[model samples]
Target: MCGRFIDANLRGSDSELSHIKIDPFERRFNIKPTEDVLILAKQSLEPMIARWWLIPSWHKGGLKDFKLTTFNARIEDAREKPTFRAAWHHGRCLIPAGGYYEWTGERSQKQPHFISSAGNEETLWFAGLASRWQELLTCTILTRSANETVNDVHTRMPVILNAEERDAWLGGSDDLTMGAGALLRHHPVRPFGISDHGPDLIEPED
Candidate 1:
């Protein structure tokens, strides 16, 4: 599950996210669940801010009603799960991030691992689902079983989308359903240890 991530582009001039105004976003290194996040949803050319934890529109109670984790939805079960099914079909989105955080080791000895792309790609797009609870918009990242590069750390990872995949996702077409699964495979990731927020966080700890 993707519990935390780094969003370096929140303040930068990202052409893909240019539609978003500058004043609302702040540079963030340790983004957590239930916090406000930037997302590019279907059919919209502009970026929008939404809660990181998705709250389905059908939910009648307050935002605190459901205690179950809605921050990350398993791709395999999203279509069947009541909380995510509606959003999965009609509310797909792209979550931009510099990298994501995961952990490994026994419960008492777990070590934090920072996961990012292997090369110059500054921003990684994570496939996500979004919903509206009253006037508040919220979203959830999609997760898949981990691939070779990250399987040693965890059994699951976020479903990452490339430029082409992002186009299909934002296009709101039937092709999205077919192409979504293919993008679920992990890319070559650069994993390093990070104890806190800093430039050195991306570097391997020796």
Candidate 2:
């Protein structure tokens, strides 16, 4: 589950996300759930800002009313879960992230790690689900079993999509064959929890 991540320039790229230009997306090294996020939803040529948590369209209560952890939806059960089902079937979207954070070891001495693409691709597109509640737009990142690069620090990682998979995902294709392998890299970083968001936080610790 990606509870926190980094939202930065990521060296720029000409991939599918090159067209996504979100204003005031100022670099953030410590983005957390419930905060505003950048997402490219289906049927839209431009990206939009959305509450980083998924709020079901059927919800009529206040935002604080629903607290079932909708920020990160598990890919395995999202298709059936009430909070994400509708969005999963039709509101699929894309979220771009420079990298994400994961913790390992004992609760008190947990070590944080920053994980990003192993290749030259700087922008990593995350398969997400978007929803509309009242006058607000909300979204949630999808998570799948961790691959070789992330399993050591966590059991799950966000559903990462390469350039080629963008069309299929936004076109409402759940048959996303994530392929037999994943290309990713991880390195230890200083622990900052939800406090510091400085760029230096991503620097390798050791």
Candidate 3:
């Protein structure tokens, strides 16, 4: 599951949502769940800042009272899962990420790895779902079985969207995976604390 990732400006002026201003978007390293994130939902031209964790629209309790693991939802059964059912049909969104972090090995010796684009691409748009808990906007990334390279570290990875698939995805399309996995590349990185912030965190470790 994708638990951590990086966020930066939405690069490439020619992108589908490039017309929208993302200046308020912050550059974050080691971004975790329960934090604010940027997302572009259906029928919206402006980018929104949403919580990394999704709280279903049907939830009626206080934020602290609800407890469910919804940071990532599996595409295979999200539509059937109660937590993600509402979002699956009408809450489609696009999550902007530079890349994501994955851990391998045992708990005592977990190794961190950064997965990013293997091409000239500057941003990776993850397929996501958005929901509004009252006035609070929240989102979650979608996942599928891993591809060849990512399988070496984990069995599942975020369903990243290519430029061609972005518009269709936001339009409530189901065929989200369009060979986008092949564009990925990953490498080991130095361990870092949650408070650490900078571009160097993504740099390769010896």
Which is the leading candidate under lDDT?
A: 3
Q: Stretches of candidate 1 above 4 Å error? A: 10-23, 173-200
Off by over 4 Å in 2: 8-20, 43-45
The whole-model C-alpha lDDT of candidate 1 against the native structure comes to 0.74
Per-residue alpha-carbon lDDT of candidate 3 for residues 1-206, written as tens digits (9 for 90 to 100): 89999984565674555777676555888799999998877756457889999999889999998899999999888888999989988888888888999989999888899998776676888888999899999999999888887889899999877766877777777774643455788999998888888889889999
Between candidates 1 and 3, the one scoring higher on lDDT is 3
lDDT of 2: 0.81
lDDT of 1 by residue, 68-163 (tens): 789999877887799998897888888888888787767776667777765445677888899988999999998877776677778888887667
Backbone clashes for every candidate come to 0, 0, 0
Model 2 lDDT tens row, 17-70 = 456555556789899999998887775645788899999999988878986788
Better of 1 and 3 by TM-score: 3
> Which scores higher on TM-score, 1 or 2?
2
* lDDT of all predictions: 0.74, 0.81, 0.83
